[model samples]
Target: MESIQPLIDKAHELIQRADQLQSKEPSVRSVPKLSKRIKAELNFLHTLQSGDVELKENQLQSTNLTHLEAVLSAAESLPGVSDIFSAKHATDEKGNQKTLVIDVIANHGAIWVKVTARRGHALYRVWQGEGDYGDKDIVEQALEYNNFASSNPVKFIVPKVHVMFLKGLPSEVKGELESVGIATHGHVLSNTDDHRIDVPCFDWSVLKELKVIHAGDPRRNRVNLDVSTMIAMTSNLTHNGCWFDYPECLLINDQAIEERHHPQLTALYDILKGKQLFACSTAITIYKDIVGNVAGPMEQARAKMLLTKVRIVDDCVSKRTQELGWSNKIKERPKIIFGTGDALEMVTVSANGSFIRSASKHNITYAVDLHQSRAFTERKEAQAVTIKKDDAFKRINLEQILRDLLNPS
Candidate 1:
């Protein structure tokens, strides 16, 4: 037993060093070495505990393996020591021998997170990286292999997959993602001092509760808008009494030119200036036409200023038609332009683009006439009474109008 004293002393020394290291500030550079040392020590203790007289060449020499293993295992059971686990991967079943590539997969209460990282500027898509695979491809494979969305744990609460970029995104790209309800972060792991393997699992239930709170607001999704509403707002701009009709609005550059300040139009501009709104490519083309021709240089500048903020949605014409149940009516009917109200519902314009109408069958849920909607009305009332000194229109009870618009009584 005297022969074991040196090995016992060394083991105690290692434990003391580890305890001291744990108390000091951690350095990312030193973490891997420390983990490896602790793992090796744990292995040595386990081997001695098994009473295997023939020690493997890789294991440290120890005579009191049983006692050492017991003590080391007990230490591991300490509250903070076992805070992390190595990320896991699963092999493909089709004999591909390729493991699903995921940086980390972990359960935090009811939410299971599958994290992927893109380290640079290359667009993330399938088979676009060095190995003919990219972050998206691996995530897609993981989803299929794990069947995550419909899996038992997810049935309780849907899983949120977060894609972390180790680099920053361009403003345009970030804005696009923001429109779709995805919030991205740059170097989330490194920024927070989270070692990939040591990230702590958290309770995701709070996120679910927050989502429930915002469930009633449609602004959570991107808002789509129609051309008629644009005309309604811009025609009121007092450029001329004849700013042209629907299709004419699209070709307004060829129309007569003018410069004037319409109060309602200015108020409408104030309402929409910073708001994130989507329009069909056609509607955008019309706005560009006006900018190029109808508007004076100053108005063109204003149009150019605002156009960048409006995202031109893809397949806008077809999507609008389909939503209106006119999939087959595409060529037969007048082109259905799209618009969104403050509530994020579809704004139905008359066939002739005369005005917004509530009785239109194409209405999604509630309808808004640009002339009479609560937001427009309240702004108009404010301008007329406060700015224009027009008492003919009393101030509408805007708070009630907003409540009615949101709750739809």
Candidate 2:
């Protein structure tokens, strides 16, 4: 703990004194020799100072690793966690390969975890470090691991720390992490005995009977079921009832009496005859054409039957609705509240990626685009584990999508 700087300074002073003495008394042969010795000793002192700084750094690194090991050990002891291993690496923004710790599978899926010994300002400093050194590495690694072929999907890469500030993680930090699909845990003081893994609660099995209809062409006049539609359908099904979304465009364009009947519309109406059907108020406008001399008797009969099943809803609070007004007073009087534009926008992104949006203010739990187009497929927000059209109907993908939709965090 003593000052090594004083010794280094003293050595430098001696070297200067010896150089001056040698210049003043050149004939005194030992003076030049003494200066050489002093210079050599100064260099040795400098080397010792360099080694001392390195020793302290190594000690700090060793302490960090010790804490990380403790965290990993605690994680392994948690119920349902197994096969814990490490030495996995990810590239930083500077292309430096940084090693992460503790890859494990706990109850659900594979998780790549990074353990941090830092707390409060230190932890935040590392997270906000230049060129994506801390949090970025974890995200990059988890994303890379997800790309590899594996049966168990990687849910998220977590940063587990032993301690945090009394108020807990800053909202900004938590928000940023969640935005990029990262999760966090372990803010308690370093106590392995009381540790618990915070797994997300979701009933993925509810989506087992989910039906996905994909239209090959984007321009095709197919049933476009949005997030509100999916939530209505799934919520009803969860409660032992059936519900469906019948868009106004589909119903108006596909009206037919006999052999030329649209198979999709016919099938949808047949499946949801006695069950609940959600449609925009515009759907009720078809009744005018049916009642007037424009429609045949068969069309009028079909329109009357469909009107009884459809529940008209105001999709948004836009001026367009105000301008058009409600077409049918009897049907659209008690309009069901659907959702806001922001909720729809969030669901739109979630539907494309099959990723959970936990920060959405609305109570939207699920969304579906039955006739998803190429635009949805091309979104950069789509996850690496995006369900392909072919696999969209698969039980596993359905379950995953449902879990994502229902995840509260």
Candidate 3:
């Protein structure tokens, strides 16, 4: 017992360090010397656990002659074999049921062990869009597995990337995992147990196509002639120079939106927000415009039903976010935005009528181009409305100004 004291102490230290490594999200490495020592201890533990008692047990247990020498060779080492096993994929008499089985060895008897896992359960099937389109890559941003890892003590993560969707199957989605050698490199969670996977599990490109379809509305009339009323409102709110906040909800630059030529995406968001949008009639007319300056004959005949009334949903910005506009986080054209009613429109369109309380934003999972979402580092030429020089006037609402400017008859 005294002789084995060092090994016991090393084992305890390794276990403690391993616990630390497994708890962090970024996977901090243990001190190099300690990591090496821990591996040695784990290996030694495996060897001792499979010592001589296993050797005799394995010899009497293995029936296959071909592996008899190999078993004996391993038995001679400090790490003696506990059992010898054979693996094969077997089918039933009718060849319908199939599974992999290995021989199990015990002091009393040997029995065939059924291998339960299959290619389907190996996790490769997940990214194949097996269940739904948009559903596959959409899960990338809001991955439950990654969130669970953040909560779990062990910090294990199912790879969020490197998964490919199989287009061949229409009803059920599948993966092209064989291209990455995931199928052939089975039987272990890690291809090599160096505490890291040689290949990255995520692919940014595969996650880009989150939505399958795009939609919008059409207009029946020529819309407004010129938006001077709105221009006055823009001047009223901007005070000639100020910044305001705006969310990325306005539909612009296409998440593959149809050649959307309606009101700028922000304008639509404002309509949903329930604040008065004060824009020039001429500008408002464009809100009714459709793609190609015209629609398909179906729409042409329906007289642009798709363009008449714009729809707003939760993706629309609300009062809390728009308050930044009042503060000029959105410095450019703040006045024009206020005149036309983009932010208030967003709240109205996206929220349930009775549900007006502000809550934490729901994390909608989707992959977006990082470059496209970059924040502006330097101030560009100001399209923003003028603001009062005093910071104390920041909370001033644009609505009263709009009523005064656009509606002054």
Top candidate (lDDT)? 1
TM-score winner between 2 and 3, please give it: 2
Off by over 4 Å in 3: 1-202, 216-235, 239-355, 358-409
Which segments of model 2 are wrong by more than 4 Å?
A: 1-61, 86-102, 108-111, 130-168, 186-409
Q: lDDT for every model?
A: 0.36, 0.33, 0.27
Model 3: worst 10 consecutive residues (lDDT sum) = 363-372
Instruction: Determine which window of 10 residues in candidate 2 has minimal summed lDDT.
Output: 371-380
**TM-scores of all predicted structures:** 0.27, 0.25, 0.19
- In model 1, pairs of residues that clash are 48-65, 49-65, 49-66, 225-338, 225-339, 225-340, 226-338, 226-339
lDDT of 3 by residue, 303-383 (tens): 233223322222223344444333223332322323223332211121111111211121111110011111111122133
How much is 406 displaced in model 1, in angstroms? 18
Total clashes in model 3, counting residue pairs 3 or more apart in sequence or in different chains? 64
Query: Order of candidates by lDDT, top first?
Result: 1, 2, 3
Cα lDDT of model 1 by residue, 106-223, tens digit = 2322222323333223333233443443235433443443443333222123344333333333343344444644444343233312332433332222332321222443443233
lDDT, residue 50, model 2: 75
Clash counts for the predictions, in order: 8, 1, 64
Relative to the unseen true structure, what is the C-alpha lDDT of residue 140 in candidate 2, on a scale of 0 to 100? 42
